[model samples]
Target: MTAADGSRLYGSDASTADQREALLSGEVPVAVYGLGKMGLPLAAVYADVTGDVVGADVDEGVVEAVNAGECHVESEPGLSELVERTVAAGAFEATADPRAAAERAAIHVVIVPTPITDEKEADLSALESVARDVGAELDTGDAVFVECTVPPRTCADLLEPMLAEEAGHDAFGLAFCPERTASGRALADIRGAYPKVVGGVDDESTRVAELVYGELTDNDVLAVGDATTAECVKVFEGLYRDVNIALANELATFADEIGVDVNEAIETANTQPFCDLHDPGPGVGGHCIPYYPYFVINGFETEAPLLRTAREVNDSMPAFTVNTLAREVRAEGGDLADATVAILGLTYRPGVEETRATPAGPIAEELAAAGAEVVAVDPLLDDADEFVAEMIPQRALYDPDRDLDAVVLVTPHEAFDDIEWERFDPLVVVDGRQYLDLSDTDHRVYTVGSGVTSAGRAESAEPHRDANLAAEVER
Candidate 1:
């Protein structure tokens, strides 16, 4: 069969075996819109599986790079090699024109940005723009899949009607197949590190989605009730992390007052099958966790008190980290107002280059505002001109004559594991991630969710007796 003949699966009379065969051959062409980090990996995997796919991006540089057999996205394990192989084998190519790619494909997948506005409303501008392009050349039997996360009901309430209007008819299939992937492990996540979730506007859309992803992934395909449910699956996953991390952070704040190691307690409590608590950190960074809560809090009229409180708690952590540093400096007979502090690891995570809502920005700003001179060091990021603190290379950060009064371990990259703590004079150290083992050093240390250490000794903490032992002794 030619590329167009018997390739359409939306309303085809072909058998399931025949449809899968057609998709595996070069007959059923696929177009993936928005070739960003997640999008590129998705497109490459589609090309590898389907043998005919086009990646669409508005950025000319990205298109040129992909067309020339190069991957612009970094830190993904096998994406670079996959893109090169797919492009060289004629199984994949990229284009700046979405309309052209849509015209030749039986399936169009969109994974564009859905950023929030300044007022914290879900911005669907990029998604809508790509939807219009897909609709302009939309065929009757073609199917559209949305793999990006948005507020729930976006597919049913907004995208379906908009696509129908633009296409001048509603014969096409539409589904919400959210991208359940992470930045550093996109390929594994896409190719079935987890079960694929698919929901649709109608039965045919759901069937088509199940068929497509069933072939693409090695894991099982979960067909939900509708598109909104699939959207919620993605958003709710992030929201759960946000709330859990907030609880961990709130508990961490009580370590000093309660005189117990909250991190250790959390780790011990999680041994029970019923309990699963996340680690406490300086703040919730990364794009997914920080913004997903707002989708629920502001998307609907219903009040989300728990989500709002979680956001407030997580947002307050950066300031809390700074305050902890200031108090530690005072205990060390040094004033933050006359100190030069250094922030290590500016990115949200250790190895990834992304920094959408990283806590380092606020930490630096608060430290500088309190009259402390701040310098930041990150191995991944090349540009720090926008940071409130001076940007120093990682090599220069450990210079003996650097004149640093305090240090905060923010991201805890692997490069910091071998640092010689005795190279410099004693300074106040705040372990924001619970990553440092500086208890043996001369530096005074304060670990979040753990108590303080001074010159290889823990500060005096009030001890509590076990309830069972206390009752037995009193009897």
Candidate 2:
């Protein structure tokens, strides 16, 4: 397929209309690298639009599953069906060989992981490996889009030259069109939950990206100045959340000291439109928020006091949660060292199995160090082997023989809402996410940002006799 036949869109004299038609008609074959959580949905969407796409992954199992039209990634609403449909229609396929996919494809999209090292620096090894594979067989007029989140200057300084060197020429198009999709709603986000952002190393690259994504997404494609700007857009979005949550966590720490309910104050203050405070919880979990600040702070030589401070504040929250649990247990005439504490919901977010940088890990460690017997309840995970707690099903947590001195709700999973708070005897309950409403119960509830709510003594209250029996259990 030649440029004259409308097969190549980048660096071509073809009109925008012709380029759009070529992209949608599958004349400009697309190859997507990294078929993980974000990448699979992206490849499926590209296939759905272009009718010709190939996804490449290093994991043999992942490639095999995709080749069999099965999605290994879970919790994505419509990804499995999309993958099956695309593969069955011969519009999309998966391969273990990246070189084979790159050789025939005119458009390359890289959505590999850019995780942080233990030293808090951006780890682009995965991205670099994928880029080298794509670049090895990249044609003169081919287009490459980096949709993974990375440091601002990563594409402009690193990948651009790296890919050019591997390709032995600088005739290709390179752009950064970072994925703005979340975990559970990948299909909606990819199809058009938000406007797509596109920026290239040069003008032609930007134009090519705009044309391709314009058809892929229902929303507008925002063409920015350069690739670095697009990278900054994604990183800045996460940094804003990290810093904002840090501010909220700092304010929540003052709830008891200031003798006022900060949650109520924050909720009321946010009604003024200028204020957009995030909720303070046990800590900020999930892979994105906790690691994005480092992409800026460590990537540059400039001193970012605010970013560093935010990181410190957010990191301290897990320990603060454990300390609060200890203090509250003491107030209830029980020692944390001798108490049986149960941690509810181990996953970072409610229903997903993504535990990367989850606060539950640190919370469990702290509870163990303090000599508390920690038992975890999470239906999403089969076992708590990674955590320092005894893994127990949600139903077994309410057994009459098992007495819990305290409970910390690290993640406010919808499953936890069905918990029978009255089953347990009057105990210390630290609502880490402030999701519990134990005002009417005998248990003393201490919400993260709210002061302790007294639930009166059980002077004449009878023990819950049918706590285990005659009730429907759900997780």
Prediction 2 TM-score vs. true: 0.92
User: What is the alpha-carbon lDDT of model 2 when measured against the actual structure?
Assistant: 0.85
Q: Give lDDT tens digits, candidate 2, residues 50-83.
A: 9999899999999999989999999999899999
Best by TM-score: 1
CA-RMSD of model 1 = 5.8
lDDT of 1 by residue, 255-311 (tens): 877888999999999999999999999999987899888899999999999999999
lDDT value for model 1: 0.87
> Over 4 Å off in model 1, which ranges?
1-3, 382-401, 456-475
Model 1: lowest-lDDT 10 consecutive positions: 464-473
